[model samples]
Target: MATTMDHYDGFRTFSWFADFVGLPIDQVNFVLTQFTALILAGLFRSSLSPIAATPAARHVYGLIIGLALGYFCFGRQAIHLASLPALCYVAMRTQNPRNMQRVVLAIALIYLSCIHFQRQIYDYGSYTLDITGPLMVITQKVTSLAYSIHDGLTRREEELTPMQRHQAVQKIPTTLEYFSYIFHFQALMAGPIIFYRDYMDFIYGHHLPGSKSLTIFYDKNSQEKEIVLEPSPTLVVVKKVVASLACAIVFITFISDFPIQRVKEDEFLKNTSMLYKMWYLMLTTMLSRFKYYHAWLFADAICNNSGLGFSGYDERGKPKWDLTSNVDVYKFETSLNLRDSIESWNKGTNLWLRSIMYERAGRNKVLFTYALSAFWHGFYPGYYLTFASGAFFTVAARSVRRHIRPLFLESQRKKTFYDILTFITTRIVMAYMTFSFILLEFMPSIKVYLYLYMFPHLLGLIAIILPPRLGLSKKAHKQSAEIDLSETISNGNAHKTM
Candidate 1:
């Protein structure tokens, strides 16, 4: 059996299963796509490691994740995930950890789990609804709002500017450099889904308030390494240039071997060599980070292909005067893992999703939380059931955590090989749960149904790995209510005055 990859959900953002469903047409339907786009953007930001961690980094991560959501909900489904944000009270309720907060949080999680399970039944298992039909009136409003900021929000285009061209001309073949911006079809499929806050930091970050001071934000007088987007028309040209180069690179590399469809078990055993299979799977796992970057880079290149050194930050925390992160945009590419994932991709919409949907769902009402997630993914029965199942299992896992923390603590004190073994085993199990949705996406059988039926098994499975609860008292979540308004402000450029 092939080992599963990391962030495989990127592929699932726009599920192939949705292909067997209907496609939305017309201005009304098209406009409605924005809701889900917004929600994906929202969730992408919401589900990240907050911006202290560098809002720009987290926002960029959100944007990457948002691209997938936009591809799924806006690009595919008529129902926009953000359209029903008002209904997603659980997603936003993170700060209020009241009495018995853990229990409340768990319950909310369960509710969300159930709802998400329903999505598996509905969206994934071939049930389709124009869902936009019922929300036409609301969508009309969304249509208007979308128009005002849609171009600014999605920020399309990928090509370099005259200076970028000159730089390229100075380096290698001009034609090859220009070609890099267009062929990344993967990016065209959806969006740049960058975090609003991180984008903000990349721009007006120097002027930012609070801890981002030169003493803290940077010691240099010229935090000029920052990539402040040109407020003028030049940005469009720059993006086009950068996008063109990135596209050209991907066309030569990725499109040549676009593994569009997944391999079935039997076909894999017979046709591909073990080494090749290992390589492919490794690519799948590692490329999740790349897949994210490719989408964003194309969008960014499209925005910044202009040859001006308006401002830019290399993937490192360092700002570049005009540095090249790519030797070829192929041989030298930054591969972002989970940590980086949270940093770079932010969408404006996820703030609401987290501040609204997932956060609102408490430790007690996980079912509602799953319900909200299911609704976001789709109104399909399979999606609802599958997601809910995941939530139920998540709850069970929490119970297991209650049991495990103490023992894990005791074990941590000893600092033995057993701790390493236990830690790895725990993480592996977590990883499996993380990608369970990916597995369900392809399997399409009663066995998948069976897994859904045993959704609680997630709890059981986790407990099997985690130590049993030792009656540990729950401490108030100190992380709650600590709003870095300045940091939050810096997360998204669109939101700031830049």
Candidate 2:
């Protein structure tokens, strides 16, 4: 009983519901698709257990559902989504085995960059959810899988890192398996970038906690032979669902009031006080994070609900379900160091960049990885500005922590005061960096930086330049005792806090 329409509207014709929800139809469509995926995840766990559903049937089901969701969200543009992955799969199977990884990486980046270029030309500054989001995720999956396959097939065991060894794909997957890994309904739309090995393990029920598929010791008397059952994901999924709704609520309530674009307006620049401007910058950026938090938490919940994200049990025997988590909410909010803050957010991208670029880059890994990150984000001038600044900022932050943090370890009181100062400094610096990232234009970002006097950049440069001139390295041994004592106290405090 489907109604005929003159054109394929990407399931974006829900104006009545949009009006009721007080959001654009496109956003409504995206939210509905996510919620629909959540529902399907529940059904996947309850009804399509490995005992009930064969691997082939599961693969076909996922491929069909994922493609339907793609078309329903992006219409004809979604064809690129399927075709790009299919092309990569073919290349992986037929291309020169020695160069498969490099070839696939080039193809994925080129295709994604072309889409980004087209988007910039056609729909610049529009915040509409589109095929590009999916393209970015697909690119990550395609490239990572290619690298893992190469590691498995081309490299010797001693050459591979422990993680690379575990995740490497020894055998070329069947077409069904490959498509299902990429287009699985739970992770297809937005991913935490599941590795090919992890996805295959999940599909085969090998990912379940305490599953007997991978026995470590054959000895019956072994202490590690105790059986532990898989735990239900109900509590974790419920918690994540609640967290997502809360983030969405905060976003809906505060996003309009603290619009980042307002900082660019003449009215705000002229009328707003400096203190108010600083406050607005921090608040707006903080609000901006909720959107990502909501998306990632919801996606993680979807994966967990389908029994995919189990890591193992904790020491207290509570199951840990964060294998696919993309954000560390507490550390993200409370970190006193820029490095920790950056690592806490968009964690999947950080891991992917570390694995695919940083580890492989022989020299200047940070610069290369940051450059690659900016490129992967697209051709936005503001992205380059932010990442370029980020590269320096990271180096500066690292240098400061090494040279200055030990100086504050003379007493617990001094350490606490230092933490307070750094917490505020880090937040302001993060907000300042994020301002350019959000604006996404050269002139606007530069204008805002000019408005703020561009002090963070100056401070970061000073942080980098002043340390060597001051001979901080010569004084390292003098502070070693204090640093050791401070570490002892901090570990005790951390245990107490936990």
Candidate 3:
């Protein structure tokens, strides 16, 4: 007989209404978690805002809520919660920056590997129910904290880059503070990976002084400049929450009917025409994106409700709300190229990879970063296949854009036509490339690609090889080799801004 862990459906709940209504157990649990966090955040903002303004109070409150939720969700297994603080303590103890980074990353990778491996062997099909997901979020936090500490303590101020200086951890936080940041309930689940400096700024209510109009005001009388607190924009939070919940409802209603596994069936491959197959793939990919859209938008709302995601003001002086936004729905949908599409989707994770991995990886940064991404996701062979294919896709797309894009730019009408063609091509290529990511198994993904005649893969190879021969210099292509990972971190500026 299969073990309970092997066949778990993720519907653990005590409410009779849930059973009576016959709701999906997984979705019910997800909604319960999101709503619970939202309510707690509102209470904290309204009733305890003054007390919670203090870092210590905020830390204690976060710890209590996080512990309670962990126990409620995972029971005795909540004991694993100790691992995060333990790792953070060890990182703090290692005073050497390089050593600290190495130790933290090693421990996090090992822990995540173990969890992912165990789940693969035992809990293969249960999506959104596994404890490993939360652990993965924790992995990002701990590793980032270690690197931030290294930037602050190990490297000289002059030696650091602008992004590095912005994220540098000036002081070693106490165990309590560290735990609070790691277990912050708002982003404890599907996260936007808040940086150490950003979290500290939120805790201390210190908005950085910049050229922007929305500067944080300070009291003049006090020698130590005290930050004036702004009221949490409840209206903005409400709008985002409502929108995200709607997206979630749509996904929950349709995702079951358009199951990704349907592509693997003989009827789907054999009976469908090429155009129909492509259209089906696009629809499946679009539906798949809604799941992420819901999670990310809901997470942003939770953070904003507690006044955590406020960055500054736009040119018109309207307050910007997206400090932890993960996806740009408009850019993701209308992207004319792979770079724009990838950058717009999972904005937070890409930022993490850029700041931590891509910048550090030297000559072969593109390949290195892609490999790290594959590793970070988990042990799925399909993940490796997708990333490997993506590497070629990037090379081909860059070649095409560089050599072909300039030819159409002479006329606005030509450029418009070019953009339209590229947009459609990008969507189809993306759907084909990411099909494996949803499938998660090697043979299924391979079979589906074979059925599609491996058109995109072959096209990508030809595109890369053909570009230079057509008089696009090797020098021109050399500049495109580096992944353009840098993006402004402010709201509504450009790519990668949350």
Candidate achieving the largest lDDT: 2
Tell me the whole-model lDDT of each prediction, alpha carbons only. 0.34, 0.81, 0.75
**TM-scores of the models, in the given order?**
0.37, 0.90, 0.89
Model 3, poorest ten-residue lDDT window? 489-498
**Which tens-of-lDDT digit does each residue in 1-498 have in candidate 3?**
112233343436544545666654444666677789888977766655643467688778877887776656555555556675576567667657767887888888887788788778876744646667677778788888888888888899988767778898977888888888888888876788888788877776664322233344445765543344464578888888887878878887888888889988999989988788888888887888888899888989998887778777788866777878888888899998888898888877787777777777677677877887788789888788888888778878877876666666668999899999999999999998887888888998888888889988888888888865787555544433322222233332232211
* After superposition, candidate 1 runs with Cα above 4 Å error: 1-289, 297-350, 359-366, 379-386, 400-402, 410-498
Residue-level lDDT of model 1, residues 196-291, one tens digit each, is 222333332332222223223443675534332322324443554455446545543663263422433456535766445444533443333343
Backbone clashes, each candidate: 162, 0, 0
Q: How does model 3 fare in lDDT?
A: 0.75
Error of 3 at 401 (Å): 2.1
Please, what are the lDDT tens digits per residue for candidate 2 over residues 1-498?
112222324675676787776677677778888898888888887788665688787777777888888888889888889888888998999987678988998999999999899888877876777788888889999898998989889999889766678878887889888888888888877778888888877776678665433334435566554333457899999999999999999999999999999988989887877678888999999998998999999999999998889988788777889989988888989999887788778777877787688768898888899998999999989888888888878888866776777777778999999999999999988888777788888998887777778788888889888865776554664685455468557643121000
State how far residue 124 of model 3 sits from its true place (Å): 1.5
Give the range where candidate 2 is weakest over 10 consecutive residues by summed lDDT: 489-498
Total residue pair clashes for candidate 2: 0
